[model samples]
Target chain A: MRARLLEATVELLVEKGFSGTTTTLVSERAGVSRGAQLHHFPTKNDLVVAAVAHLTERRGEELAERAAELPTGSQRTRAVIQMLGDHFAGPVFTAALELWVAARTDAALLEAVAPLERVLGRETHVMTVELLGADESQPGVRELIQATLDLVRGLGLASTLGDDTRRRRKILDQWALTLDVALDKEKQ
Target chain B: MRARLLEATVELLVEKGFSGTTTTLVSERAGVSRGAQLHHFPTKNDLVVAAVAHLTERRGEELAERAAELPTGSQRTRAVIQMLGDHFAGPVFTAALELWVAARTDAALLEAVAPLERVLGRETHVMTVELLGADESQPGVRELIQATLDLVRGLGLASTLGDDTRRRRKILDQWALTLDVALDKEKQ
Candidate 1:
């Protein structure tokens, strides 16, 4: 029932946004009695927080899978960034964006989101640092990783804004290439 | 009278977004009579369209001003990206984002926003070519500019989502530095 509610919440979030979504809609979408939802989450904020946690956790799994597919150091770094781009085009991101907007003023969502963002930050740092292995503690690796994260975050947000699929693909490819160049610069 | 309402509409957009904003609240905020609002903009869509146009025009002027202030080629390029970042942080972007969410369902807003995006995109491209002293006719320059636009767009959206100020700054610097690197590579 909780899993169903979480799914329903994401569905509604992608469609109606945080402010527009309601417990009634979530209940109807989840096919559960309203009482069941209340029994589990007790509040809408609780449900949204749980959904975000689900998002980042799922991201972690995807990152692991992408990393597993890569045998080379450079390949691992690119895969991790690609995983982020792919996931951003997926469900968790679509819902998280709405909550992020509402979070500008909604203190509850703001407080709930910080830990999740930290998890994402740490996961990305780990992925990038691992790819940099021998140079894990290099002077500018942190800056590079942070830039990539920000760029990916920005790309995800912009991708949702308009119908520019071609442009989106180009952006991703270019960033991947730029990362390659940045890595080469290190070797030089 | 219309100007005041448009100004207030921009403010409400930043605070509440398109879905959250309403005619009555805008009328109330603008200190205009409710009947007067209807006299100016018969429909809410009209008001939104007008506000978007107002924002787009203002942004063009703002960009021109920013470009004029930069005395160096590199600074000029950074200024343009920074302009994009700043533009995304306020009413211009809140309106764009709101339009994006609304566009998911409303074809009208999707149509309404294309030209605005084009204006920004072209401005970015022109600024990039001018700053880099690169040939726009060249395929690689187009790729580089397109990627830079994505980075700026993404950075703006991330910042809007409350990416930390320092972190966002680093991303901006890295973008400029990456552009420089890409240009240096192209020159060779």
Candidate 2:
């Protein structure tokens, strides 16, 4: 029942944003009783924060599995970029985007969501580092890895409104080449 | 009166987001009456869209002026990154973020905002190209300029929730170096 409610929350958030996802609406969508929802989550914040954390952890694991399959080299870098591009354009990102906007004005939401964002950011950053086989201790290498993440995140945000896949692909290609050059220089 | 209402709308957006920025609140903040507000904007869509367009144009001009003042070479590239970082963390971007989130679920708002976003995106891309003093006619050069924008935009989005300025600066520095090397290689 709790899982169903959380799933409903994610769906409603992606379809209708923070303001539109009322407790009643979520209960209705989940086919869970209003009493059961309150029993599971006393407040909307509890419900939303749990839903995001659950979704993010699942997405993170999926990305890790995908990253583990790629061969090391520029090919892997391109694949990782593609993976992130797809992640950002999906429901997980949409749900997160809605939360970020709502949290901008709602201190309570921000308080609940900020730590979760940090955990997700840190976990993803570590995943990217491992996927690229980057030496984070090296001068400037860590920052470059982060820049790659930042670039992908921005592209993903743009993709939310329109089909930025072609342009995003171009960016990933160019950035992959640049990363190859940077990594080579670092080794020397 | 129109300009004041627009200004109030932007302020409210950055502070309260779309659902929070009611017509009554905007009228009160703008020091205009409900009748005048209605006369000027028949619907909330008209009011919010005009505010974003106005803010985007003003920001575009500010960025152009800033870009024109930078000395050519790697210095200009770094400055442009800094400029974009600041721009993304500002009120204008905040207001735009609200609109984007709201528009995601509201088809009417999406119809109103999509074109303005494209215009702002194009103008910013052109400004970055000019700032880099890059040959847009070249194959990879144009994409590199775009990657820079995408990177900064990503950084800016992250910075909204936390103090990412230090990491953002580090990314800017590394990316600027990578860009310089890429451009140099292209020339040779």
iRMS per model in Å: 2.4, 1.0
Each prediction's Cα lDDT score?
A: 0.71, 0.85
lDDT value, residue A55 of candidate 1: 62
lDDT for each residue of candidate 2 in A20-106, tens digit (9 for 90 to 100): 999999999999999999999999999999998988888888887887787664377777777877888789998998898888789
lDDT (0-100) at residue B79 of candidate 1? 61
Model 1 misplaced stretches (Cα beyond 4 Å): A71-78, A131-136, A185-188, B73-76, B185-188
Q: For candidate 2, lDDT tens digit of each residue in B5-86?
A: 9999999998888999999999999999999999999999999999999988888788878867877643766776788888
Q: Which window of ten consecutive residues has the lowest lDDT sum in model 2 chain B?
A: B179-188
Model 2 chain A weakest lDDT span, ten residues long: A179-188
Evaluated at residue A186, the lDDT of candidate 2 is 33
Which docking band does candidate 1 fall into? medium
Candidate 2's docking class is high
Task: Say what the interface RMSD of candidate 2 is.
Answer: 1.0
Best-matching candidate per DockQ = 2
- Assess each model's interface with DockQ, reporting 2 decimals per model: 0.50, 0.84
